[model samples]
Target: MGASRIKWHVVVFLAPAVLVYTAIMIFPLFNTLRLALYSEADQVRAFVGLENFRRLFGDPNWSGAFWNALGNNFWFFFIHMLVQNPIGIALAAILSHPRLRFAAFYRSAIFIPTILSFVIVGFAWKLILSPIWGIAPDMLDAIGLKSLFAPWLGKEEYALTTLALISVWQFVGIPMMLIYAALLSIPEEILEAAEVEGLTGMAAFWKIKLPLILPSIGIISILTFVGNFNAFDLIYAAQGALAGPNFATDILGTFMYRTFFGFQLQLGDPHMGSAIATAMFAIILLGVCVYLFAIQTRIRRYQF
Candidate 1:
């Protein structure tokens, strides 16, 4: 009787959280998906069933922006994978060094950017890089590389990559701290034993430390994957809703916004917007599933 009562108490306590989550998150998510199958008719909603999705993907008027945004989104993910992860690992390794002075200061300095508002970082970088502001040009000229400096964010060839690098600079701290903590969790005796076995420096790191930290690296990789896919605020703040110059920096987030809210000249189409959102959700879900099933399974055997 007492055990049953205790179970009931646990259920009662947990019910609120579960209910709230179901209502706020899961419910809304599923509702939005359902809404994607609908279209507004004379301000009254009606089920259209895949018509919105077909139009988004098949209609030329909609397809160009959809494909463009999706392509940019992938490039954004690629930048984080290629640049962010390696740099973060290197920073973590440097931070883990025993002889390093002012370790706390370094960690705090590195992480401070991650704590700032996206609006601040985005606008600050915009001003610094703005050709009109001349900061980038002046800094480049000081280094005798002024000719190499261009209005990167304003150029179609470089806009997406520039925004990506800015994001990497701001957010690399997360992976750095995570990897650093993982490195610290490793037993000192393991390193000492490796040194005893004539493995030191690069070899010690590669052979001993690297293997042990692989799991943390894996975790960081997955987190980066999720974050890059969901990214929006930085690009939107810096580039505006249009992601100009002439949609040069357009990504899925900005694309979704444009579709949902409409810009100065374009009319908002909620049905198509919902379709785009559904597509983004599907892609993210697919990535997570692949990681969980394929990459995560491979990681577990190597973890111990």
Candidate 2:
């Protein structure tokens, strides 16, 4: 067959996916961006240009909630980086050890939480940590740290962090699985050579395995960035629309939901809601670009 005909086959195979993606993904994205440009007038849509953007950033009432949600979202991402990622790496390292017994069982056991629904996971954790339930306090008392067991979810000082920790507890499996796959992809012969060179055990991991897996870890970090930024369901399930304890857990997702759908006494503002979604899209895009051009380019992956 001619090159044109051959290329057409590739096109044919990809056509279904392209159509589906365009209908479900690209169309909605551009539609939202389009919506951000318009305002409702007389129950009709009117093009408002950048007026919505200005209102989002310039109006005190809107700006306060926007900035607060943005800040809280960043903190949510930061907590995952500091706590969830390191723990996942540690677990992956342990699980990837050669000849480790029950590694499969252990991985499955740990990953079970990741497959659970957000509502189920969030509510279960909420109940477990509820002070009235006394489960958390009992565990703390058993460990002689009962004094440290405040009603974390109810206290504004700790609510966001508490919810974040719960999120981390649920999603750590993703990073662990990703890192484990990366570790397992390393060649046995390469490791054997490292051993021959007297780079055994911890030395081998530091000198060889870690460098190889840095790229994978980088990928995991970017994925975490995307997931955390788009996150809203868990926070919603655990904290409700207000994200109370005085809105401490309010992130972009919940904020957008509240703004779009109208909650409590507030009226729904479609123009502003579209603007918020646009902002979230921008934030996620910016993060992905930074990862790609900044951090990702700096990470060197060695071929086995």
Candidate 3:
């Protein structure tokens, strides 16, 4: 009777959260997958199976845009991995220094941008980088580096890179805070032992702290991967549905948006959009699975 009562208690406790997740996440995900299997024609919806997928991959008209967006998404994710994560780790290391002063102030200042609205960050940076009547050029001129100032957001070569950097500036704090907490959780006894062994300063960080925080770093990396691939709002807010300068800033999210909702003269095709979304889901799922099954396993083995 007691065991049965305990089982009921467990169910009661878990039921609400499970229901909420099913309704919001599971249902929508499966529904999107279902939608991808059907196509609308002549005001009639019919089963298309993998036909949409073939069109997306094999049809030149769609394939070109699809590949371009996928490539840009990779670059965006790469920039976050290359620049943002490293900067975040470095900042976390600096801020976690035992003797550091004004640590809270610095942390709060850096993290404040993370909480800001994406629309605000995108538009504000757009205006700041505007070639005319913008502060970026004026600031450069004031510093006697006027010749170096160019309209970064207006150039196809630079627009994606510029937005990537802006995204880095906003979200770097997340990794920093996470890593900082991980650093703080290191047992004092371990540090004392390290100090006794003369593993101080950079030596201590490299040899001692780094290995201990590897799990945290791994978590942060996967989180960044998921977040970057799902990214849309900032690009849309900054560059519009077009994701211009000549679609250079186009990522999967914006591409999916344009396909799903239609823009300007383009007709909306929910079937194609669902296919794109499914592709995104598959990509993200693959990445996460790789991390969990391969990278995470390696990390655990190393720690052990």
Higher-TM-score candidate of 2 and 3: 2
lDDT of 3: 0.92
- Give the TM-score of each candidate: 0.94, 0.94, 0.93
RMSD (Å) of each candidate, 1 decimal: 1.8, 2.0, 2.2
Candidate 1 stretches greater than 4 Å from native: 2-8, 301-304
Error of 1 at 20 (Å): 2.0
Estimate, for each residue in 230-286, the C-alpha lDDT of model 2 and write its tens digit: 899999999899999888999999999999999989999877899999999999999
TM-score rank order: 1, 2, 3
Give the Cα lDDT of each candidate. Answer: 0.88, 0.91, 0.92
In terms of lDDT, the poorest run of 10 residues in model 3 is 295-304
Q: Which window of ten consecutive residues has the lowest lDDT sum in model 1?
A: 295-304
Compose the digit string of candidate 1's lDDT tens values, residues 194-233.
8999999999989977777777877777787778777789
The Cα error of candidate 3 at residue 225, in Å, is 0.6
